[model samples]
Target: MTAGSSPRAVVRRYADVTGHAPVMPEWGLGFWQCKLRYWNQRQVEDVVEGFRRRGIPLDVVVVDFFHWPHMGDYRFEDEFWPDPEGMCERLHAQGVKVMVSVWPQVALSSENYDLMRQNNLLIHAEKGEDIAMMCWEPCTFVDVTNPDARRFVWDLCKRNYADKGVDAFWLDEAEPEYGTYDFDNYRYYAGPNVEVGNIYPLEYNKGFYEGQLEAGREGRIVNLTRCAWAGSQRYGALVWSGDVGSSFQDLKAQITCAIHMGMAGIPWFTTDMGGFHDGDIEDPQFKELFIRWSQFSCFLPVMRNHGNRSLSHPHADDPSLAALDAPHERLLKEEGEFKEVVRAQDGSPRFYSGADNEPWSMGKEVEAILVKYITIRNKMRPYLRELFDQAHKDGDPIVRGLFYEFPQDHRAARLSDEYMFGPDILVAPVVQAGARSREVYLPGGEETIWENLSDGQIYHGGAWQTVEAPLDVIPLFARQGKDQGLRKAIQEASA
Candidate 1:
């Protein structure tokens, strides 16, 4: 790479070393709905049915963590998830795909723990207790660095999920987040944690990718993960910013993060639409933040909404209550035995839950705003297909910095809040709260023209213009000379 090399040249060098980015699955290019959880089989099905009744376009509905009996039980709990196959069949019948969450930590009470422990397939603590992570229960991470361990976990997933019509996996806790960040005390199969920690997410995705391929499933492997290393893109890893706060500052950080992730060679990136933590659904302030974040997310490579929305009523019926009452209650009951309770560092039993995060979970006013953007995202599918094709064939990022497209535009080099959704569309999301307008910079040659998608106003390129941005408006513009079909789609959707 030369000193003044162009952005394309820099990205090309990255691809040459890491391999071209995976072609995004068509379903992935549409709207995906997720939250902290959907507790039982019926709840999951009802949510999918709700989307249909509401006329919302949902391509994927995720079953977040704790769908299983234990943290490490690869299979669904027979008690809560009475009919996995039937649930998947019903969802597929509705033209929706299912994505199940899988974590790297295996609890000591898990059925597979003894076998993994005996085979040295779990990470070990070099000092004090043997626990490598302590979430919900004392557990250790699977040594994904070991090929045999990867096969073991993948085989379990294949038998439990793939055979039951599950379309993808959410590889959560890919960071192998420890209860404490004592990197010096942990040891992995490859080496110590600090020495090889960054590679965990890559191998985490690989385990599922290879498993899907070996099972003869032909569709592209797309797995949602929390973190990624350099070459994780080759394994079809869609990395999202992890457990962010619900604030305007956090939302602004996501834009810069997405741009840098693309520059770093991982083009598949998304964020929790309304941050991941402390978002009270009933708070007027929080609702405003959620609306703004949702608008920004519409232009990302993968349009998905996820977070732990704060709940006002915690006593809602949930399977997790049983686990919280006695961390080993369900597991011990199934095994015909009894054990002591598992408590977190704070002496209280570890329990987690979030409020309803569906399109209608909030009030109708918020619901209307979410539905409008989701409809626009769905309408742009034809344009998205072309964008994904370009990404696959030329290593072009679907969501990139303005500088990537206009390397010579000196002003573009510093524009971080606005970005190019692709070569044709410039997205200027309102990152601040209570802002009714925003200034947008359109970059191109002298002959270029820019058309505003919201009001159909046209402007000459290589200049700045302030645009109106109401609650429902995201400042989006199309470069006039290219992709007329895409331009028309934006116009129709805005209309």
Candidate 2:
């Protein structure tokens, strides 16, 4: 298993056996913006406009889940999203890429459900009711394992989304997250879910990856999926830890996830910046947690800001959005055998949209902190792009454990809290709540020197140093003399 070598050597060997990541597109490297559900065309446009007005560097804006008439409609709901093409064109004109969400669940009431069901494109329940998930309604997962089924879905996506200037797809439910985990109950065209379920996400991404290639797209395919299998990296699957809660505990867990996911060969990774489940935007404790997490997110391979933030108010002046703060009563009209599309009182498709999560949505102090980190991320794009190129060329990870670089240092081998962002930048994220400073272990003995990126203070390796980590500063150190210009840029940005 490739023993008796450095960690980097072992990872390179692993890449030789499996595969290397594709070169990521330039836009995919910068900051991405998203919330729970940007349900309408107008809301999506407004977020882009907000970023433009504030001059925040935004690479991609995600229109997350339930923009469709139904789960399997594969097209935007006409009533809510009046002009998908024009909206995408407008975003592209602003230099922002659009990522639309697509789920595998085919509801019984969806317009294409009958066609899919008759064509045997849906997953089958061997002995019970054929429903695979009941998350929003009774629905079955698409058997993406089948080539015909893969082509069937990708064709719809190409016509409805890709053709409309949408730049990428968020393959949510790549796990086909079922309402229940009875793996044996379901079967796919490939095999029984329990036996071959691991391949589901691989094929799930392969469908779109192959489709994009067929459409003549080259070196620019990025599918942000929730789950991934072995070799999924080859398909340009940027995996994110899914549906986590908002807590300091959850924040600590992401560091481990990123490091291990990179080790496991998924080079591209991200997380919901403020956690996905519940983050109260106005809570002082949450704002602190969010600031800390946003700092951690700055060094990830893809720096994306997303969450389902709990809000006290809608923040918009529209009276229709007043219902957003209220309980989602699931106002629905029956179709035939199943409950139909989730709707609001005004007969529009309704999914609970969280509070404003824009860079400027938080209070002035938090907003200033966010803006600073975003500026730093934009400035580091060249460095990040080089790291991504390494990943593509050698199967090396963008986020790596200290042991990968300083294997001889016993303390660095034991440390889990700090990691290397490529070979140059060292990131020690503040994972605890209300903590100002933390001890950082700089590896590589006297031969290595680290420059404090924020203030240009210097420190030698193979020692533990307690750094001053204020609210605005994320403890970052540049290795040796590698990023002098970047160091100056960071100091100026902080200044």
Candidate 3:
């Protein structure tokens, strides 16, 4: 994966659905696998209704992968959705844009399979043979590198964008399928000998980005790529850390990882909203963890919830994956028995078996914390909008660290665990559990106001403050003129 190219390189004002540069939100909301179930339609409609009823400002609603009738069929089932355009129009009327997940591979014995085969638009192995890999479907990777292949893919998107009236795309699983565990092995008609495995998402997204560009006015590309390589940022994309497991350690690591990514030149940074793996939020203690995680997540560019729905599973990384292995290994050669060859790939079709990471951890108590922050977030929409404006005008991140705003201060340079949200605010979240107090170092700015909205108490801030938070508070500090209030007019409110 290519790492270094240029940062401040102006890719130009992006063309979008409105024929102008889209004003990216202060942050976004994601309901991962939660939005894809049979009951999801009812749940989604009810939620959308709830938001509409409450006048909640929702910028985007991500519909995750395979919402269509048959998995990998890519057809919007008339049963599930008789009218896709009608759905989009309704959502748009409520000022909500839909960004749905789409995969790059076409499954075996499908129409897309025949299409790729006829055009030779799929990927191939190093030996110039078909390189099939394991995915949910007996899927073969599409050669997004080829011009004709790109055009074909864009055509598919155009149907969704123009005919169906969708808004954006969340390109999922762009990582080229590789490994001995898979069963299928079809050669892709992509760039010659592109052995790069992890770099696939970058290559994969280039088409969507450009296609959206070529789409003229019907679409805007908002790719939530899981596996991104270098130079992936130029496509005007937002990337989340791949399949992060749920754990306090992982939560802390997520913060560090986002900071590292920011330093590496990726401005829009995020991970799974609640940790994607391990821990039971059903337990009161863990529910508190999820609530705390959500409190911190609002500051990120994109907030997404992913992974297993069930909370009863043990917290193991690779516990009892399914028996249906990738078909790449089995499709070729004289493999003895189909049963023996069907080595089930990791996890079930819709479930990640490893760990249990669910929201509603710590239950209503945690919900109270999240709701409080969400209220504050709602209140700060005006100022937050200004930040988003700046991010679009100049490549800047919504949530920055302490040092980024205080580069001159050696103390700020030393504070990696904590960071400044923008130019003024400092956020030092309690990354660990069972912690009454966490250490926070400021840049010794001119003035620091430590305001705990929970208690309506304000503390003077400048140096390190090892405050006793007790797991219910997010330590937020205002550098100086931090009293910016909400800008958007609240027509009708539901407190």
Candidate 4:
């Protein structure tokens, strides 16, 4: 391997060390809708119904964390999600895929915690009071390094979810994120956490991927994980930037994050669209930030929206109120008659629900912008399918930095805000707050011509241009002489 090698060569070297990237499922090519949660079965159905009523394109709908009775039970709480099978059936009927969140932390009171602890299948504390993580309460991470542990958790998921028609999983907490970064204080079946912690996410994804494969499920396996290591891509890990804030700066970081993730060999990537924290749906500034983020999401490998949008009235500090609205209250109740309700440092419930995060939940102006970009994402599915094919066959990135395509253009190597969405299109997202236009550097190579999707204006490569970007548009340019069909699709969507 050579230092400062071409991006293709670097990616190829990565594939040589790891394996080729997994094939992407066709359903994954379209837009996915997610929030902090869809708490109840009715809430899930209503959101899907709202999308259909509004005629917005939705391919996947996620049931985020706390749907289960306990963090480790792997089954829906009957009080809230009374009809898991029927809910899946309804979403499937609408041609939508269902992905439920699965965390790796097993609370002390979890149904299987004793069994795992007795069998040495949970992460151990080297010096503490035997607790490995503290979320709502004391919990331990599953020792994914142990084969038995992986099978144990996977069996629970397969029995509780896969049998119920759930299509995929959102593997949250893949990082096995600890309350503290006390890496030296933990131990795993394979080794001490300090020596093996980095591989935790790899094995986390592996558990589900191997389980799905063993269950006779075939064709591309797509599991959304919060973090990943080098070989995680081969396990079908669609890694996402975790729990980021809802700010313009955070949105800007996501662009570089995805581009670098692709460069690092994880081709499947997404973000918490609009960001995950402190987004007030009613706030004008937040709404503006969301529109810009949503437009940027349209060009990524996976276009999924997620976040904890803030409410007009703050209720997180009120324990009674948070318990009333919390998704995992049943677990709290089960753990010693509500005595185990995990309170934050401030005496509030550890979990807090956000304002409604559906596309229509936002105001009309934001809703229309989201709907337009979503429509554009749907139209680009054909082009995305081709990109996925190339990814599977050649380990190429669907979402790549300009340097990947224009490795010889020294200027393109340093450009982070602009990226090439496959080889045919260059995407320049509006990353700053209150900015209506931005400068874009078109990578120059082989006498290339770039076409602006918004105005059909043509510009030669190897130059920079200040492009106009209003609330509704982020700058999108298609390569002039290649993939004419894709160019037409961009034209129709932009028009």
Candidate 5:
């Protein structure tokens, strides 16, 4: 319970107690393209090519979960990802970095499972069948709580992934997302799950952070993680809201969550810019939701687009998937068309990939809007870099609630729908479906002037103004005499 004269001051004091987030790499500040799964090497490359071909600025492309032969393989399946080093090199040549998904689950069939079990490097089930989760297979988590276990996993990752030119990792399922939240059944090197479960994510991130540092990588390391704890920011963890449903309500919830996460001392926060589940590419409603979400995401610490689209099935009988036939037969023989445990002979789950979630996949109109916001995000890179610096040095949030910048204004404290992007820009996102115009409060006295970024109008602070928000526009105002470059970016985006 630290208090200061202002919210920023309180944040600084809180950060001093919990530790500040790492200075994010410039690439991490740019737009990241991802989906539920980029199933193979060609698909990942194709998506990057698609972005480049359209002149969209993409900084990172993620290889989501189940790219390997099995859970806990810590390496890509050669059958699917034949030339890891070459693929990374090609992506690097195109100026896009690769982030591979890594889950904590180690299935019973994993090559290293026996070794890990012998060394007690896997999380132990104190009772029952020793399986921690049963999503695709009966599996146990690597005991990231133990120093030795952390080192063991990191060593495999360094040898297999780093050596193959992977730039960063998507540390998925960091909460060790159990099949059931049966905390008492699990035990870690640190303690029983009920006693020490909260620390799991922190240690999960710490292992990679420390391992990267030991390998002589500095300053540029950032890992996308699903969960985080008190000091996870110090370990270069960029936390995103996990597995969120696609809805207007979820979008509204993200605003509050971002503010709360920053106040909790984790300055780096992002959400899947179109939500993670049930967003259909062809549906007009989803397109509207995605457009609004993309606008909001442009102001976030990291701008990312990801989701699993409805009716976009990977096994839709396309000839391109012909290579998967033999594997599918083997999987069916093993699991008998029970899609839940769709595994390869090597025990890796052959999960179905979602529909194409690229910006262009969402029809031309939505594509244009998404590209516009992505361009705006690209132009704000300098401003974002500074915000990240402040977060690293002084623990300021990149996405600030109205109260964070205007502590004395009681009305500002109550505005959750609108927020500040750093100290300069005030963003009032269109949160409701089919709402064309909404009221915005420009806090501060008459001396404070606000420049309406949308139509280049002017307003005095401490006044409520109704702003028109078409499908293409988000209400933006740059604080007069502050971040003039932000206004320039907005102009450039429109241009």
Candidate 6:
């Protein structure tokens, strides 16, 4: 917390193979699951070739939960993947990096479980027993708060980073919870064992961040986790809201919830782009949700197309939603549902409340709105980079509410979903129903320039702009003279 503290070094005391700070300039895209078989030597070549063909800036490809054949047995599938080292090396050659997901609970039947269990490397309750598995495994959670446990996880990473040439690891399902087990007297390494809801994920990622620093390398090291804790930011970890269902309200809440997380020090966060819960590859609603958010996600820090990827295409067979926004996107045979206006094929249709509040099944208008916002994001990469730098150096978010930046404007506090990415831009996304237009409150003295991302319309500062924001466009504004206000106000103020 001091001026001289090495954020990286303080973090390194906990993990296995510490490396350097992230230095990569390009942003990345992630997915919810990864397929092990299709990721073999020859298969990876085809995958890399596919990305090159799409011309997508596919820098980091995530190999999520699917990579693990079973719990604790963490090794490449030799029969299916004869050469993982070769696959990674080839992906790197194609300018694409590999990221594998790792869970904290080592499976009881895993090849590596005995090594950890016998050494007491897993998390134990305060009563001093190994933490029981809740969701993903039959093993206990690792006590990340412990030194030995930290080293154990890091050692695994070292083998991956140095031996297999994996670019990064996505720390997944670290949300430590207990099932049907009642006693709150759970164990921890040394700290007081508390009924911590989701702290393990944070510790899991923190351990990895430390390991990355010790390796003396500086590239964007990401921890795409399902859970997190305070100070997890220092570890370069990002959290997506979790596996949610495909209800329209969930989508609306995601926007506001993410804003809240950003204000709480997690500027780099998003949710299941398309809802994540139980729909199959053929769900029409799911398809539309994917396209709409995939377009919206283009503007976010990390882009990922997750959920049930085993299907050949996500409702691409349905050409129903292709009226307004299908003009520029890569509409595959399975990806066309998001291009037009249509009704949801399933789910509680009542969730589609209004213009911005409607689900993808509402129509093409919403999809168009998302597409327009994405175009703006692509154009503002330079500015996004500026905010990312602030996040790295000073914990500033790429997006934030107006009050955090302009606390003096007491009125700024009310705009929860509407926030500024830094000192320059203001984003007031629509998150309610039955509303064709919305109200925007501006700071009294600050100058703003609203360059509509959907259309190139520019609105001047000093007043609220009652602009028409069809479902396709969120109200976005840039402060015209943000720096000048500070300089002028400080004419006589000094540090």
Q: Which has the greatest lDDT?
A: 5
Task: Give the 10-residue window scoring lowest on summed lDDT in candidate 4.
Answer: 330-339
Q: What are the lDDT figures for the candidates, one per model?
A: 0.83, 0.86, 0.56, 0.83, 0.87, 0.55
Q: In terms of TM-score, how similar is model 3 to the real structure?
A: 0.75
Model 4 C-alpha lDDT versus the unseen true structure: 0.83
Listed in order, each prediction's TM-score against the native is 0.90, 0.93, 0.75, 0.91, 0.93, 0.71
Q: How would you encode candidate 5's per-residue C-alpha lDDT over 5-28 as one tens digit per residue?
A: 888899899899888888788789
lDDT, candidate 6, 131-196, per-residue tens: 476444467767787778877778876775446877677676666556535446665665545555
User: What TM-score does prediction 2 earn?
Assistant: 0.93
Stretches of model 3 off by over 4 angstroms after superposition: 1-40, 53-57, 69-72, 127-131, 177-199, 217-220, 279-281, 313-363, 445-462, 486-495
Ranking the candidates on lDDT from highest down gives 5, 2, 4, 1, 3, 6
TM-score for candidate 6: 0.71
- Worst lDDT run of 10 residues, candidate 1, spans 331-340
Q: Write the per-residue lDDT of candidate 4 for residues 1-495, one digit (tens) a residue.
A: 323367787787777678666778888989898887677789889999999998998899999888765678888877777889998998999999999999998988899889888999899889858876777778878999999999999999999999999999999988888888889999999999989989999999999999999988767589899999988988998989999988888988988998988888888889989998878787889999999999999989999989876655433564555654565442233212222233333444535445678888777888888888888888777788888888777778888989888888899888888899898888899989899999999888648898887777898989999999998988988888664365565556556
**Model 3 local distance difference test score:** 0.56
Q: Candidate 1, after superposition: displacement of residue 95 in Å?
A: 0.4
Q: How accurate is candidate 2 locally (lDDT)?
A: 0.86
* Model 4 error, position 329 (Å): 14
Candidate 5 clash figure, as a count:
0
Candidate 5, pairs of clashing residues = none
Clashing pairs in 2: none
